[model samples]
Target: MAQQALPVRTARLGRALGPEPTSVSGVVLLLPGGEESSVRRPSPMMATASVRALGRRLARTGRADGLVAHVVHYRYRGWNGGEAHLAQDASWAADEAVRRYGDVTVCLLGYDMGARAALRSAGHEAVNSVVALAPWLPEQDVATPAEPVRQLAGRRVLIVHGTNDERNDPELSFRLAARAKKANRDVCRFEVHSDGHALYQHRHEVHALTEDFVLGALCGRGFSRPVEDALQAPPPLGLRMPLATGFGRSLRR
Candidate 1:
């Protein structure tokens, strides 16, 4: 059955919902990046082609049952790293999703600042996993009451950053993964070589990894065998990058 985009509402929050099915397998809260000035003029989440594409993919290829997806539009457009304005919006959306869907497992997918918000908010009760794509991490020290890399201790987390990205250094994402690992948190890092922040060069790979994680979390199967094996084998546990380039570039400039 072809899934259709439908409207899912919350009393006073922003709009949410993507291709939904009759029986929802799980819920994903999708967020996009924005500037502080956007607080007065937030962008519509559903309008983002990349975000909708991911939602559609989940709706189509997820297990036997489809997934419920929500793209969040922040009440405030900016990240407000010190205050976590965006994470609060995500929390509201997650709460509404839980209220409407009942105790289902929830996954979060976000990009740039949105990724920061998702990671900050992953400690919530309903979230089981998080996928942060090209997340913007400057100096890697931004933490609000809503976040700390340690907050995600028991949840599955994936951080995919492009090595060539000039906007946000991939090293920040790596540092985040390292911090989580040091604390014994479940975390995976995929450093995409030759790609930029948008991950345009490896969008398909990003989608596959995200889909696998979401499906695994929802079905109670955990990560796939290849991922499991990789995670258990070495230093960069579950790190996915092109096999051709050996570690891509030096960790330093």
Candidate 2:
């Protein structure tokens, strides 16, 4: 009897914004969050909406720099434990960017579970930097090993978490950032005080910081003073730097 063939899952890229792929100097891949253990195809969700909004903003802001942005549509709706479906999808997106754009730099901007995927996928050769917003990190326990930071070496990483986050532990992200900083001095983490996992309380500040880090990494622009200080400061201080209000307004001025 002939065995039935299994279906193959594939990740895809959403419509892109900004300059065409061949003309762009850099690309930003937006990875959206999903559940911890669901294989179901994703429907529109708040997490996806968040990253989509961010992608549009990045496309608009980066247009003049010849930067392009795309939202990554994953094969499944979960991290799926060790399978890490989303991370694999992110790496595929990076590879796709390289295939389409030659050797241009790539940045991964992700939220929640997507943030974890971005961090994991940064090891891709085409990826130059990452911006993780309210990342959902694994709990410290024997059952689940700590996420690896060694892969972050030679890449710039920015992790932003809300101090009052209830869904994901900010401490975990700080720990990851501290470890990553040892491997790459460009790693930094920022805390949005009194905000929750969604980081709605400081959305503008978060967006501003992300823009600063991504542009600084891919377009050779200077990072804002706070980000620069956080990246250069010693552990603890750097890992827990507080994000200030009006940060975006100040940057524009």
Candidate 3:
């Protein structure tokens, strides 16, 4: 069946909106990557094909009816290492979302460096879940003042990475997820085989996976059987360690 088109418009304070703001089932904040053009305009990373598709799908699909979606535009183009200025921007956007939605559920969706911002700011009380695509976690990086992974102790987090990524090491994302899981946070890590950091080869698949999580988290509508199977499938390569554990062996009776 064909889906109806959702209204879209630019809002004040660097936000893009979909659907009417009077009432909404949930609010989704989309954070774009740090890669910017010479003029600091909204780069392709800001509106990745997958991210844009997910926003439109949520707006039109029955599972996410009345969802309010926003893609944030950052003030600058380059990533400010350890400063987390983008995290501050995202946190402020979250506050504005809450003010507009009035006690509604909220989800943070991000790609690349934007994923870092979302992960760092998940400590906000209103965020119900976070979806990060191709997150760039540099090696040997001490946690910034933002303390990104440490903040997801009680939030739902989904990190999806591609095995063929050349720009960012997929292992870094796995390590981040492991840390989050060890903290007893609800977390899931999925690896897409034969794809790069941008995931251009399988764009639709990327969008579909993200859409399933966002809808489920916000509306309690679980993913279809096919999607569920894909998510549960074993990794294409590398070790798949358990994200949870029983009591320490020494403490066993």
Off by over 4 Å in 3: 1-17, 36-50, 62-64, 141-147, 224-253
Clashing pairs in 3: none
The better candidate by TM-score, 1 or 2, is: 2
**Using TM-score as the measure, which candidate wins?**
2
How close to the true structure is residue 46 of candidate 1, measured as C-alpha lDDT? 39
Scored against the true structure, residue 122 in model 1 reaches a CA lDDT of 86
- Candidate 1, 78-185: lDDT as tens digits: 665565677787788778888888878888888888888788888888888888888876572345231367768788887888889999878778767777776654
Off by over 4 Å in 2: 1-6, 18-22, 44-47
Which residue window of length 10 is worst by lDDT in model 2? 14-23
Model 3 lDDT per residue over 1-253, tens place? 8986423422223344445544686888888777522224345453444466667666665333657787776655545664466677788788888887788788888888878778988988889899988887667635533235777877767787888989888888887776676664457776778879887776666666677677777877775443344344444222232211111212211
- TM-score for all models, in order of appearance: 0.80, 0.94, 0.76
Question: lDDT of each structure?
Answer: 0.69, 0.88, 0.67
CA-only RMSD, every prediction:
9.0, 2.3, 11.3
lDDT of 2: 0.88
Give model 3 RMSD, 1 decimal: 11.3
